[model samples]
Target: MNSIIYGPVPSWRLGRSLGVDLLCAPGKTCSFDCVYCQLGRTTSATTERREFVSMARLTEELKEVRGINADYVTFSGTGEPTIASNLGQAIDLARSILHLPIAVLTNSSLISREDVRGDLAKADVVVAKLDAHSQELLRQVNRPMAGLMLSDIIAGIKLFKSKFTGKLCLQIMFIEANKNFAVEIAQVASCLLPDELQLNTPLRPCPVKPLPPPQMASIKGNFHNFRNVVTVYEAPRPEVKPLNLQETLRRRPKL
Candidate 1:
């Protein structure tokens, strides 16, 4: 059977993270085709939600990783984890089976829907991606599905933050396109009131080159008002070996 669970992949933010892919479909399925995506451009881009992996299968996979040394069981893979309709159920199952703190990394595309917000609320930590502040920048950077507006996304995040008791971290990916607009994106992130702010760029192999440490430091300065801030360049990367190297690379290449 194709593995729905992969990694103990090393992460700067989550330490040794075990990844769970609900949408284990052919190629990458995502709502946004980000310019700096390491898995390359999005193969399938849509806003509709559906059940791709069954709970039974996820339970079986979770059982295999019960003793794995992972800091968090992350709901992320080749696609957006929020697009999975049964995400809340999956989180519950993973938590019950593995007893690890659940984390979900979202592109903040489908959060406008109340169902999606409810699903995301199950996680212990939600790393919401907010790369652009304006509609034009949204198009240039995120290239989201049709009818996805910047204003609606921001409002959705705000609403989710208001009710979520768990940690809400805002992740801002800075590149040449949006480097100069750090202050603008920072202003927007500040309004959302994220518990932690993560400034990141494309350090992995991708179409875009990662900005040097100096540039990233300059960008971090824009958010000096924020108490907790972390940058990709300065973060620690722990040593890890995946249970299945092939499976891990299938989801996150160059791991």
Candidate 2:
């Protein structure tokens, strides 16, 4: 079978994460043309969702993952996870067969929609992106789909905060363009009162050059009031044997 699932990739925050691609055919689809995207831009930007792959097929692949030891079962690959309308059903099915906690990485643009928020609520952890506090900066950094308003996105995040009881981690992808507005971004993050604020900069080659790592002393002095803040830079990879399907499954906990 052509693999619908890929990578027990090393994630700085989630440890060894097993990724589930809900959009794209192994590679395709996305909501934003992110400057720092590792997989490049979406050939077709869309909000529509379908069963990108059969649940039966995904379940079969997941059975292999069931033997791998991963810290998280992440809903992230080539694009935004929320764009998949069948996401809630997929999450339900995955939960039924997998014992690990689920994490969804979203751009936070669609979470304002009631249906999207309802679906995301099922995730154990929702890491939402908020790179810019102002509309202009939002446009520069994310280069989101046309008609996506920054104000509306913020409002959606606030709405999700009100209804979802799961852990919400605000991921701020700092770049040179938005570094000057760090204080303002921190203020905006304060309002959301996220469970955690993760400060990160582009580690991958970006369309635009990224800023130098934020001055830790300065950033700390400025944004310490907001909930727990954690800053990370890319860590050097350790050489290890590449894991095969059986080895990966052996490490994973039974559902």
The best candidate by TM-score is: 1
Q: How many backbone clashes does candidate 2 have?
A: 10
Give per-model TM-scores: 0.98, 0.88
Q: Model 1 clash pairs?
A: none
lDDT of 1 by residue, 1-255 (tens): 668888989988999899898998888889999999988888988788999999988888899889889999999897888889999999999999988999999999999899999999999999999999999999999889889999999999999999999999999999999999999998999999999999998888799988899999999999999999999988999899988998887667322
| Alpha-carbon deviation at 97 in model 2, angstroms | 1.3
Q: Cα RMSDs of all predictions?
A: 1.3, 4.6
Clashing residue pairs found in predicted model 2:
67-249, 67-250, 67-252, 68-248, 68-249, 68-251, 68-252, 69-251, 69-252, 112-156
TM-score of 1: 0.98
Listed per model in order, the count of residue pairs whose N, CA or C atoms clash below 3 Å is 0, 10
Q: Candidate 2 — what's its lDDT? A: 0.74
For model 2, residues 51-147, the per-residue Cα lDDT tens digits are 6777787788888767676777888766778888878877887777778888888988888788899889999999999999888888888888888
- The positional error of residue 206 in candidate 2, measured at the CA in angstroms, is 3.3
